[model samples]
Target chain A: MSYCVNCGVELDRTAACCALCGTEVCNPSQPVDMTAPKPFPEEMQPPPPNNRPLIAGLLAALLSLPVLVCLVTNLVFGGGAWSVYPIGGIVLFWVLTAGPLLSRKPRPVPLIALDAFAVLVYLFVIAALGGQGLIVGLHWYLRLALPIVVVVAAATLFPVAYLRRYRADGLVTSAILFVDAGLALVGIELALSFFAGHPFQLSWSWIVLISCLAMSVALLIIDRSPHLLAELRRRLHV
Target chain B: MSPLRKKSRPATAYAEWFKLDNAAKLYPAIHTGKRASMFRISAVLAEPVRPELLQAALEEVLPRFPAYAVRLHSGLFWHYFGHAPGCPRVLPDIKNPMLRPRFREKPGFLFRVFHYERRIAVEFFHALADASGVLVFLKTLVAAYLARAGGPGVAPGRLPETVYGPGLLDPAATPDPEEFEDAFLRYAHLHGPQGYREPKAYHFASTPEPIHTLHMVLGLVPVDRLLEAARRRKVTITEYLAAVYVDTLLEMQRREREVLHVDPRRRPLPVRLQVPVNLRRFFPTKSLRNFSFFVNVSIDAANGDYAFDEILPLVHHRMRLGLDKRTLAASIGQNVKPERSLALRLTPLFLKNLAIAEIYRRVGEPTSSGAMSNLGEVEMPPELADAVERFEFSLGPSFRIRTNVAMASYKGTLAITFSSTCKETDLERGFLTRLVRDGIPVKVESNR
Candidate 1:
């Protein structure tokens, strides 16, 4: 007997609110019959449970077995602590793959930070072990390697954070990423110059920076102009 | 002998295996956890459902539906159906019906029977049967249940001659070979050109509900008022409803454009609907297995803002042309010709699945914005009809399309149910409110 005043459709006797518009029933003549059976049952079937974390945990355990074997072999044979190499590599692999799988919602910024830290730890292990002719002890790691990893990680994290915060579409995301790439190249050149004990000067990176920045500017212009963006989408649609 | 008293046959009489029908071949390949090719048909009885009697009825009635009594099995090249080992148990209905069936699970059948309060619903995997076939299965199951419950005038020995219409089948009769035939292969003329590909259509943008959650909105309108509206317009009921749907979609798109601040001159994509036609009507076949095809009807906003009246004839004639036997047969031929390819038959099942899934994404999923399937009016003998109040039909969720419409009428009430995975009810509201505005009274209910 009751009708949704908003939708103009008759509401079911058991319905307390309008199903279409969510308007509360206020019929003075006929009150909602609470005891009447609902059109559908109240029981909800839960979705199947997710097995992703279990699988990821099993894979991580399998990965750890190799690290354990190498460590035991190195300790028993009395080798020069070479077990650190295998152990560090395996740990780094686990961080990159299993870390995201374990978390409920893996945010890009935190995952990237973890990965960058793992890379740095692996490099530090090599430096500490005095890698044969590859690393000049801690000096090369501190001056060149540390700064490059930091700059690259920062460059990667900036755009991801920006995109997530602003909810940017394809064009804006590409523009931001391009700008990050241009800045990272400049930072890498400066790090190299500092490591070589030369005056801070940009050289080969200038061409890359100019090209990347120009593309970023063009993309931003297209994103800002609705007419141009629509034209481009129509032309490039496949 | 009365229809209910007819002795039920044993399941051993059914063939052990069956090839997936022409239209059915795509569902198994593309079915996923989120996108299950399933639909439901239900009958609302006049009294509360007795679960025990319903179960007994299911056990008796299932043996009559051999096509529905099978489980999905994968072959080296294509998926097929094998006779299920046990009778599927009738379970209590859930708020969310038609979640994808786990074929490996206990009740290995591809279809399930459920009852809630006064309703008996059958949810079928589309690979098993289309809506028309499922409707017949549901009607028969309901008839069997009523006979078992021994409602007044619905005694096992007393039934009207008209009860065994096209929908309700005699449980005692031997399984019809015609019902199991792949009508597509039988009717296809392979030399005809393949069906043409259509341009991508526009879909509404909305927040998706969580996995396995489907929201259903049912709007019940009197069939007489709807039929009168269609009669005045000189179009069939399907065409009239489709025009109203297109008009609503047009209005929604305009509002979306305004909110997004898009250029007014930018041409909007066409609003296309996939209207499924029962091929059994056009061709001479009693196959209850998948024997249906869809016709895509569209209106482009780029042409101009079209009024409801303007869209009516366009949809009406398009449906008239699309439902022609030759057009349907050619579409069927295009579908069946690939199954006959020697190289395709030799391809591994995994590779074939990949190819079919890709084709569906490119061609099948993008061509229609949404689907509207009308099962039309369901008829029953007066003895059984008095025991039934109404019937309902609903489509399962689609991977790309968020909302789909299904219509079925029983007695005098037409239930137009909209099944959607999106959180927004704007489309359902617009559609139902439009009907209300057009002098049709709509009674709205939902499984919120």
Candidate 2:
């Protein structure tokens, strides 16, 4: 029997080198077993076909159909370039869905920013179809839709970014949710009032906002008082 | 000879489809490209395998395993097997066998055939069948090939069949199919816990190897010496090996703690080995589909240090208790009960997949330090057995299990093959060296 001189572990009679340490054995008295059975195949097979290109081709084919149909309809009907609506819609939809699927690793910030841009462009198409000039379209997109999407996206992205760095307990997460909901509601009202050409006036949003604030305070109090939290958990059987 | 002539017709001539057997339903739901649940069972022949002959043997044997020929089709509430288009090709053996996504290449076929030099191997997605199920298929294929190659007293017309019964060959056997039925669902009851659950155990962390590069270390030893050692310990070979494995992990843990100067008051995680039990032994059925579950044997280090002797009895007793019929049925019930739930059944396929994958991630590998599947003795007809050199079993890397062992004995050699996705060789080295210290000679091999 042959043994690995370096590690002192028993070596297969056929091994030229130690399987564990890769030290070549040079024994004149006991030659290596040259014809031992190999455990794995030496030759590697051709890699499997990469289907990314196929997926891209299929997506392109499916996405083009709607734009082509809409472009044809607009030309035939001669109705104020209405084709832009479906064209923009299709492009916007692809950005939101297929864009992430096409990538090996997707960073959420860039993808979400692209989605927000797509929404603005789609709205711009509507504004242009309304016979508004570039100035009016820009005004509505910049003043209304852009601000609302930004707040909504921030509401999502900030929490995700925070949670990614550190885990939050259930109570902390619920508290954040309640406060974020109230802030989002307030932001929506401000943006709408700006569009209506009215001063910052709180209406039904105040009542909902107050309720959200109260919920957040209650959750905080329960978090601080462990006994109350335990009692609640028992009652809810959570 | 009488049986061969009486029922020699193709098994598939009767049906082109089948249902995913009881133990196979969960695989289709959670399987992915990276974490594909697949296992490989291979046989080494006395002569180099000819590609054409292996292909011919596959063509002959493919019709016999009709259950393995179908492709997976997702239904609203469940997944079913449908007939694949053409025959699965017998390809050249690849470096990595089981981890590659075979279903994507051959959309419906659940198993693949590969030949490398003198070795002929088949890798089956866990959805296809357990190791026991695949072994019979592989043995039959090898038998047919040897017969065609002109083995003594063996004829190509009569391939060696499983001892399960003659219902395998009859074309009318499909009328009362029992093997393809999900035995788990058939015998599921709420008598015990649905599945084994435990607190997450410690994982062996390491510098991750390159993607798709799994390191394998194989140790070959005489079956007699190991059996004698087990006899001395008054435990089975599996129990003995598991004890050695747990002891190795404990040693590693103690070393890590000593180096880091960690407090003794801190609770050390339990070291558990997930032993897959072949339900076929407890339940009677001839079906070759997946009919197995796992019994987790654990040693909690929080109490105190355990010697090798202490761990062996603990593993033996735990294994006996875990194999209880009612307990196994309850475990089966745990899995099937979820499938039977109205809420889960009504959930959309995509949602169900998400839920299942999440649960598997949390509860699957973290609960076990490693898995050791003992395929037991491999037997073949005397004529065909003479033409075979050895048999090996390999399980692909799991999401959390970085290292695992698969063992099978043929002739006088017991092959213990370790499939690992990590760079460290501590666990394998420790286990083998302990055997050597105990006076069992080991001949180590590797696929570096």
Candidate 3:
């Protein structure tokens, strides 16, 4: 029942190597299971890790911490204002773009869509309830909220669809991620100054929101297909 | 449990780009964040002939090798614990009138730190220390020092001991202050590598992955036959092999695209290759640390569909022209000055690498397609045959780039082997197969 992972030649139980190509056969139940994994002998590799699940879980928790903190802060200090709802927006961003959710796996579209939907709902709730607390008008919400909504929606949903269909991936290279993160951080800093109680308010949260949106979308597209990234790395031929 | 530490942290605009660029600049990062597997090649020499004897004769080994010597001047000799030899410390001074320009207003650090044993190391720091200009030259100084430490003049005979490295670096050893970092290449604004950019190719937090290596021995015809073959080709053997590699690469690039359904337009990895050229061809130096400049030739993926034969001559031509005897001679005779200042030269290496790192972003992740170093012919007296059965060569990558080719001939046979620290093995198999197809029989001896 075993077949070559490469070339797909059917294998025999006792075969030490591919009868046709001489590639060592990896059939375990067969008498010649010993021929498996040759060429790349196991002794040459580093020790394998034992705690993959723990590692993944930890990474996921670490990524979501910022979102958790934002929620806590909003309920306590956000004064029941729709403005505080961006905390939900922030959390939504992480759920979609960060952690295990963002790692390489088969069919990431649906999973990503769910996170984006959650974030969108949270943002919508915040926008819908904006004027009730903590210094606000619908105009501020209109400008910032719409952008947040558009970006979050695009980042959350677009990449999933794009990746499912397989297209326009290089747009999310690590370089783009770097640029996005940097600009978003600065935007957040700048937004604080234009609104809120302090010289700068969470209005700057929009910067991170945008970065999160961009990064989420970009990573999804890249994950969908890394043809461009792989080509670049291969040419460097390092 | 506490959350795992994240190496990829969000950064502010300018800082983040700079950080990532610095990461890209490092040869190791360029190798995909892989750890460097250490290589130690040892060749035992004849018993304790006077150290000075071998050192004295080193200059005669090759016309292109650097020459310079180190002396403690007695009182200036520094020392560490239970010293069998070497100073606790000694400064590395500029030697060989040929190196006057490479030296700065202040004497270099190499002049200060003396080796603890008879060993004279030629080391290239893995971006953790001095800039390449200083480190490589220092090693050249060490090569020259080998000649000096051996003595005034070594008559033609076998070296008494082994002269190879993987020599221990005693972390606890104390030292005096003299430094490396060549005094060349002015980092100015309005030009690329603009205004004092640092050379420290930084990797934020991801530790390098473990590297795996397997050695192979392929016996071949003697150096004489290889030389004969080269002469027949009307090209240096180095050129011949380089052609083979270039051709093989072009083939592989084509196959990868077709098989993977990849776009054929873009070159796989857009890289700038650095080929070290001995400056000794330009200037006469009695010093071994000649401080050579690497000539870079990038593979143009845009020119992908082309055949190797078509491109081979162009590469051969460039390397030959770059190494032209008369050209280097003329530059050397010009008495050019060292490029940078002492303190200023060392500063960028420590602060942060901006341009060297942003290579991928600015030039499009321009990675080095590994490196090709044809040490060419390393001829010793024919009498040293039994002690040195066929010779071999291996080149180490600087910081960002891994994987390199080193070819040398000792016996009458011409043998070649490709070395890679990476896991993928297609490049090696493909290279060997093509050479065999070209009529050179490949007898792969399984060491395992």
Candidate 4:
């Protein structure tokens, strides 16, 4: 038994330094004591996230402005409806603000609702305007519904299925993040098609195809290789 | 003919073993500098060393200092060891000095020869020996030889003792292993720069720091004043100086954090310090060519402020913990192995280039904000001190780390010095200034 001279703390024979104060314990003639004061672990907390709700609300507002402007112009010049546009914009912003919170899992319910809302607003605004009249053919519905169906269904079912079906692997998490990025891109394309009114969309299809292809490749390649999966887990953080 | 290659029949060999730390591979471009370097410290005892009796003295000394007597056989078959083990020493030199060291060239044997200089010139091969072990080995070897040569003339009535180099070198006969071992190890580790940049110079044949880069400034503090200071602090002289370095680095880190807004709380920064311990307590090796290995001691930067009051006992405690005879003896046994290459897959290219860095990582990538090597309590045969004047140490920049603080004492005064390969970082400014500011009276000298 000994005491640290610097801190005056009673210590075990093996103490390298004072455990509390980091004062070196100088016991020369003692037996080897296994319990030496060792260094503490050094994992630092990340800097506090600058999470600002005001900034979030402002971002939501900014996104809603352009859609509102287009809707207003349609009402005046192209005989579009005034009421549906503002209401849809409010609902879309609400989803943008609370998508992660409201979805028990990533249901994509908000995105689907927004996609439908955008189509309805575009048709009503343009029908009132009487420029290119509101026409919702089966092809248009197929284009709009297919992506919404895949995203909403996948978002709702993937987590539950993945938990039950896929084996626990490191790469699975990052694979999921990329998959969400692909779905978000699909949502953007759908929203764009609604505003344009006349959809002669050939080239945009490639972007959707590429995003899905990349997400699948990232998943399949990462899943199969253990070494690569470890690498991905270490880097991707997701 | 060449300065580094010797004129002897059996060429002197030095082999450095670079074991990786935590089995981790290094990324490219990391600066792995030296943990410490060879203090440009030369002890000028009263008399100049005699050249005439050198070989005869070596014959008497070789059987005694076992650590200095062994020949190195590395894993690199053609370059170091023979095609088979323990082959005769008549191997031809077919190696190109210009080519970078490869796995075939690894398990390096640093050939050392104490020839053709008023002071013994130890010509070292690239991969084998570090500066501290080699320098102490050189000093001990020559001192032992001198002791033997001046037999009755110098040895007085002492027996032909070759069992331990440090023991024989000490005329005072204080067999307190506890007190001296720490001093020896501190001295050994302090011989090079504090830290070196790794990955940057990860080749065995990579250029060492410019020899001129290491410089010294010496001053005299009477033996009594130093002794008083040591007594006042209830610490040894080595402990007092070690405190200064620990404090210096701590202060430097503190100041840097304050100025640069570095969050010390993030991951407590490390400023590990290593000091070389000479293994003269257990046995004597006569050659004195490679006599010491380092005992490392480190203090985290955030632990406390740099104050002598806090630092003194800290130094004493670390020294006491590390220099226990059993630990030291085991360490010596572990380090004094005849050279052999590690069995492995393909040799990592980094290992070939970064000899010191690779070794540093193995030796616990000492995250010393700096190092302090104080070669304490050196005894100059009374007649030699008059001719030699004083001693101070200098070392090459190490692998991975950046700065070092080195000192050695003679005639009771300690010379404190710093060296760095980094032209940019201000490692020496704050702490060294503190020493002078607190009235320690540091005299500054540098090659720059």
Candidate 5:
């Protein structure tokens, strides 16, 4: 006897809410008939279970095989901590490939940060094993590699954070990405110049920065103006 | 003899097998858990359905449908069918009717029978049968159940002769050989050219429901009101409804442009519908295997905004032209010619699967915005009709198209069911509200 006030169609007596709009029934004249049989049964079919964790576990076991062989060879042969390089490389690869699969809901920020940390550790292992003094290796690592990795991670994480915080449109996303790229290039150049003992000055990075800025501005303009956006879409459609 | 005891028959008793028909060849390659090529037909009786009786009825009537009695088997070049070993257990119906059948699992059957309250439904994988064939199977199954249940004042043996009408066949009779033949291969003229391509169609961009969850909304309308509305428009019910669907889609596209600001480049894509035509009407064939083809009727949104009136004739004429025997046969030839090619026949099943999947991606899924299938009015003998309250038909989820419509009318009520995987109900609301405005009363039901 009750009808959805929103859709104006008679609702089935068994329905507590309108199927189309999900509007709750609130008719005072007639209450929902709880005893009426539903159109469908109550049993629900569950979806197929997730297989990512099992795959990740298998990958972990497969990856450990090479690591084990390298360790055994290092132990049998009288090598001086040489296995650290190969072992570090394998660990880094595993983290990059299988890390996301381990978690049910992957948070991009932490995963990317972990990946950056792995790369830094692998590079440090290589530098430490360079036969150079530990002091020298540590010096270069802090001066050059650390800053570069930090810059790349920042470049990736900034856009992701912005996207997650405010679900931006495609044009806005592209604009933010362009700006992030420009800044990352500047940071990389500064780290390189400082490492080589040259004065911090913009070189080819200026061209990339200028180009990215111009593209970002143009995209923003198109995004703001409907007519221009429509025109661009028509011409550039796939 | 109890049909359940008949299950102990020797394996030799059910040895017949079949090839995947021309129209059926595409389903096994393209179907996925999310997008199963499945459909359902259900009949609600006046009284609660007894599970034990329904199960026995299925066993008795299933022998009459040899095409539906087998399990899918893979061969070198194509997937075929072999006789399934045991009777498929009748399960309690789920809120979501048709979950894609995992053929490797137990009961390896292509179809399932389910009972919920008064309703007895059968869900079929498209490779088994089209809606027309499934309807016949369902009708016979229900008839058998009724005979066993024996309603008041009715005796099983003394049932009227009229009870076995065109739809309900005798379960004791042997199945006609013509019933399982591939009608497409028989009717196709191989001289026709290969497939024709159309511009890509517009698709709704909406969030999808979780896997295995399908949202169905049924709008029940009086058949007389719908027929009268179609008559006023000088078109058949199918034509009128399709035009309305196209118009609704066009309006949704317009709203997307004005409100959501969709990229204008997509404006050129047409709002096309794939309306499945039962070829049995065009060419006389008793073959129950897949003998149906779809006609793509569309309106280009870039041309201009179209009123409902303008869309009607365009859809009507396009349907008439597409349903012609020559056009349909040519389309059938386009599909069947590949099966006949010596090189293709020699190719491994794995390679053919890849090629077919790619072709469907390029030429099939993109060509239609959505699909609408009208099973037309279902006719049952008076005895069964009075016992059965209503009948419903619904299409399963599609790979690309988010929403699809299926219409089946029985006894004076027409049930227009929209099966969708999208989270948004805007399309269903727009469609049903439009009908309500046109003076047809609709009572809404759902498995939300």
Candidate 6:
């Protein structure tokens, strides 16, 4: 056996250098052994669970149980066909929470639109069950809830689309958000007024519109002029 | 799975499907199309490779390795392996070969076999197997090719041949059940005491080259000279090489400290090396799957500066302690315990993947300065061995750890190949130069 000159420990025949230090072995009297078996094993082998897939498929099945229970309870306990509302609500909830998990690449825009569509469908079902029928109930639902939900979706979606397409910074994104809020508020007021059979007059919307306009103008200035924006940011601790 | 056909093969051609082993579960969870945990083991022959014969050999030898005939599949709680529909096709090697082989790109295969001039390369996604397993596959493929192409001496019984003929690869040979076992789980004590904790280790810093382009530095060292060097050092070759790596890392840290003008009071980070222990050595299993775990062999720079001589014995001791059966079992228990937890078992695959990736970032590379996977010596039957010139093993570049060193010896040549995604070559240069300084003969080759 050859001893390590540096550490005074015995070396393995297959060793090329000291395991402890970075010292190389050099021995004239003791030659390196080449015929010994290596310390490691040479052979290799083929190196479990069905319940997993069943559980995933069961997720849809399990989630549907709550909707089923609510439907039966509403129809049995109550006189009117009010079960449609809770059933629609549960279905909409599932679409929002679990639908994205199914997709390879779930973006925000399409998912948000899907959420809005689910809510609209739910409202139409409620109108049809609680009101006259699909014909007259849907007419009222389209006039009121459809316009309101569409405007709300547009308000959330428009800014997202703009920000994504332009790759906007915080200042630009905030400005767009503020401007869209004002427009959505105006749209809500217009839809309510027209459905309510009253003249469209901006009341709560006016205050929101002015404040949003001011914030949008300030953000636009900050985005365009870097110097004043830095000063304002420092002074306001923003 | 599409019912419609494109280039569909006959149903009988597909091989048996198998599940990913316990150690392999992490790879499939974390692998993306761009960043996969993969490695390559290649054999360079004395003569240039013929693509047609190599393809035929691949076809011949594939039936012998039923475990490798798999593709990734999504299950409810975990990802799994399913039998791919067709046989893997051999192709001419690409310019840069270790880029993640997407399941779609390879048309459902998890591994690729490539031939370029004199070299035959097998690149595997870690989900398929480890370095040792790849070496076996490469040797068997090469052996089969030589017999068919009339190139060299054919070792009749040594090659994997079917009962019917030489062209059919082990058609009747049943896959050993032990080959597919999770040796870690089988050997580990369910309630065993946990292993030691790892202190944050020093990491080499460098500006990375372009993504997916790992620079390979292959140092061809004569086995005789290296064996002599280790003998004089009075340590195993693995221990000696690990010490050299630690020394090089320490030097780099000192330079960084001087350049950055860092405070002297700040404790020096530990220089730790993650040395993989093949579980097959400890457990009586012949698994060709991932059956290995690494122990962090370290030098505590916090204890103060360590001279090369001082660090040598410490590394030798650490390696011994780290490889002890109980120590390995305890470490394996720690990993397997988490895997077997009821909470973790119940978790959905996607969410578990996210959690696993985060845990790896926090606990994986931080515990080690670098990884040194010594595949030791690859011994083939004398007749097949005579035709092969060299064998090379390389760990693919990792995101957190920029450089990983892998070495395999064949035909009296120890080819230590270092793969790094970083632009810096300081560690490799320093280590090789140290060997040369110690009178060990080393010839270097690089793909920069």
Local accuracy of candidate 3 as per-residue lDDT tens digits, B1-448: 1111223222222121111111112432222222221221212222222334333333332112111122111111111011112222231211100011111122211122212123232322222222222333333333334333333233333343433221211111221111111111111111222122222121111122233333332223345544454566677666666666666566665666677786644346433344666553454332222235555454565544556566567667867776765443333322222112354335444232343345533432224455555554444333233433333444443244334555545445444434443434444455555554555544332122
Relative to the true structure, candidate 6 reaches a TM of 0.64
Docking class of 4: incorrect
Cα RMSDs of all predictions?
Answer: 6.1, 6.0, 16.1, 22.7, 7.2, 15.5
Tell me how far the alpha carbon of residue A219 in candidate 3 is from the true structure, in angstroms, after superposition: 24
Model 1 TM-score, all chains together: 0.83
The worst-scoring run of ten residues by lDDT in candidate 6 chain B lies at B1-10
For every candidate, how close is chain A to the native chain A in TM-score? 0.89, 0.72, 0.34, 0.32, 0.85, 0.69
Q: Which candidate is the best by DockQ?
A: 1
lDDT tens digits, residues B1-448, model 5? 0111111223243356667888888999887535569999998888889999999999998888877888888998789988886789998999877888878776689999999999999999998889999999999998888888865344555356677755677888877767777778778766766665687788876898877888889999999998899999999999988998998899888887778766775444689999999999988877777889998888999899888989999999999999888878888877877898999999999899888889898878888999999998998876766778889999998888888999999989999999998899988988888888888889999988
The best candidate by TM-score is: 1
Clash-forming residue pairs, model 2: B22-B182, B71-B108, B179-B287, B194-B334
Q: Write the per-residue lDDT of candidate 6 for residues B28-61, one digit (tens) a residue.
A: 6666545788899988887778888889888877
- Tens-place lDDT digits, model 2, residues A24-83: 988888898767656576665554555665777688789999888888888888978777
Q: i-RMS values of the candidates, in order? A: 0.7, 2.5, 16.0, 22.6, 1.0, 14.7
Best of the two (2, 6) by DockQ: 2
Query: Candidate 1 — which residues are off by over 4 angstroms?
Result: A61-130, A133-238, B1-19, B73-82, B157-166, B188-197, B336-367
Q: Estimate, for each residue in B1-448, the C-alpha lDDT of model 1 and write its tens digit.
A: 0111213223343479878888888998898645679999999888899999999888887888888888988899888899887687889999888888887776578888899999999999999889888888888888888877866567765345667766788776677777887778778777776566677788888999887889999999999999999999999989999988888898899889989997775568799998999988888777788999988889988887898999999999999989988877777878888898999999999899899999998878777888999998888777787888899999999999999999999888999999999899999999999999999999988988
Shift of residue B308 alpha carbon in model 2, Å? 3.6
For candidate 4, the per-residue lDDT at B429 reads 46
Question: Which segments of candidate 5 are over 4 A away from where they belong?
Answer: A22-29, A55-238, B1-17, B152-166, B262-268
Stretches of candidate 2 off by over 4 Å are A5-8, A13-37, A120-140, A158-238, B1-14, B104-107, B150-176, B190-197, B251-268, B301-307, B341-351
CA-lDDT, candidates in order = 0.86, 0.76, 0.40, 0.45, 0.85, 0.75
DockQ of all candidate complexes = 0.69, 0.40, 0.05, 0.01, 0.60, 0.03
Q: Which lDDT tens digits does candidate 2 get at residues B24-134? A: 766776776555788888898887888787788788777667777788777776677787766788888877667655664555577889998888899888987899878
